[model samples]
Target: MSTTQSDRLRGLLEPLVDAKGLDLEDIELSRAGRRRMLRIVVDSDEGLDLDLCAELSREISDKLDETDVMGEDEYQLEVSSPGADRPLKEHRHYVRAVGRLVKFQLAEGGDLVARIVDVDDEGLDLEVPGVKGRKPTARRIAFTEIAKARVEIEFNRKDKKEEEA
Candidate 1:
């Protein structure tokens, strides 16, 4: 598939995400039935909330409508946060995920979870635990070996406490 359209969609969404201090996780702008589906998955360093989703959806939809980026046909735009199971890729992906716990299945067939200690154009340097004594070890996984990676939701005490507090 020509990723040009997809890139264009990302270019379109960047402004809104930047304005709100949110990271654009992923975007799939394509045709689904009679309308196009503009799936924007966003997140933040802290996390995501219902309010954020609503705000982004409203603002992004208005901008898209104003710009007419989708051409003549009507389209369905979905602005959502990537949630806990969201994948990690790209420089911005790792940048947003810095200090967050993440899990990924290695190409050789083992899963690892660790805090993202650092990320750069070079690769992902994670603070993973050692298998033996549970020592904190920094493992630099090359971007090529990263078949899959996602933010791991270790716990949601804040979201829960808000329901109580």
Candidate 2:
């Protein structure tokens, strides 16, 4: 869709989203067969639940119906959270991932899979897992050093408290 339409939609929806204590992360309008699909991704620091998604969807639908923002085209609206494995782009994304395993593609070199121990405005403290029974080593990486990063799902993870005990 056109940038003007996207910007208009953003302007129209952002306030509604903010009023509900969430951020509108993204919006996409795409053609699906004869109908258009408008997907809205929303999130909050407290995270999203099914009830919130349903509520937001109803609110957004009502606003759109009143605004004439999408012309007269028939469209489907889907509202949801950014699922696991979304890219870590903003500082808040990293902050939310502080206790999770992440795969970082370094600007200077290769990939590193590390558990995030901490995050600050400048960089992150990661615990690089050791091979075999060796102790994990701590590594500091500046945000500038990262080209790409995403949270990695761990199935057989051990709790930090259990490990300490």
Candidate 3:
């Protein structure tokens, strides 16, 4: 999609998302078979649910139908939250992943899998799990050192409180 079109869509939809207590994370316009697809990814600190997505979809469809921005083109609108494994790009993404395990690809050429204990402007405070019956150790990683990061799914992970108890 053209930058101009994308900008226009963001400008139009951002306020709507914000008013509903969510952040508009991404907007994509792509081709799906013979029709165009407009995918809107939104999120909040409180998280998202199917009912919320449905509500936002209706609001977005109404806005698009009444506006001239889409120019009467046939397109399908999809409103969704970012998937669990989506890359952590922005500072807010890292903040939201606290208490969850993440896999990081270091710019210095190595990988680290750890749980985020805290986050700040400079970097992250991670709890790296130790092997061979060792205790988990605390570590820090600067933002500049990370090439990529994404949350890792844990099927049988226990909450910190549960472990402590």
Candidate 4:
């Protein structure tokens, strides 16, 4: 996508999302079959629900109808929250992923899979899982040392089961 078009779309939609108490995570315009698909990913500290997504979609559609930002093309607008595997790109993303398992690619070298225990402007405190019945170890990783990071989905986590109980 062109930078100008992306910027314009952000300008038009950011305010609407902010008003709804959500962060606009991303926007993508692509061709799906014969129709143009506009995907708007939103997120909130408290998380998002289906009802909120429906309301935001309606509001965004209304705003788009009043503007010429998308030109004359007939497009389908999809409003949704970021998925579980979304990359941890911002400080807020890290903060939100606290207590969740994450896989990190270090800039210096190597990879680490750990549960996020805490986060700050500079870095994160992670609880690295130990092997062979050993206890978990705490480690600190600076943001600068992280080449990339994403939340890891845990299907059979003990913590999750405990939480349910």
Best by TM-score, which number?
4
TM-score of each: 0.63, 0.90, 0.92, 0.93
Off by over 4 Å in 2: 1-3, 158-165
- Model 2 TM-score is 0.90
Off by over 4 Å in 3: 1-3, 159-165
Find the 10 residues in a row with the least total lDDT in model 1.
154-163
**RMSD, every candidate, angstroms:** 5.1, 2.6, 2.2, 2.3
C-alpha lDDT (0 to 100) for residue 90 of candidate 4: 92
Q: Model 1: per-residue lDDT, tens digit, 70-129?
A: 788888888777665667767777887777788887887788888887887877888986
- Which is superior by TM-score, 2 or 4? 4
Query: What is the lDDT for 151 in model 4?
Result: 97
The reply for model 4, stretches above 4 Å from the true place, is 1-3, 158-165
Q: Which residue pairs overlap in candidate 3's backbone?
A: none
Tell me the tens digit of each residue's lDDT in model 4 across 1-165.
Answer: 556877899999999999998999999999878789999999999999999999999999999999888999789999998999999999999999989999999998899999999999899999999999999999999999999999999987667468889
Off by over 4 Å in 1: 1-3, 91-145, 151-165
Candidate 1 lDDT score at position 4:
77
lDDT of candidate 3 at residue 133, scale 0 to 100: 98
**What Cα-based lDDT does every candidate model obtain?**
0.79, 0.92, 0.94, 0.94
State the weakest 10-residue window (summed lDDT) of model 3. Answer: 1-10
In model 4, pairs of residues that clash are none
Q: Which pairs in model 2 have colliding backbones?
A: none
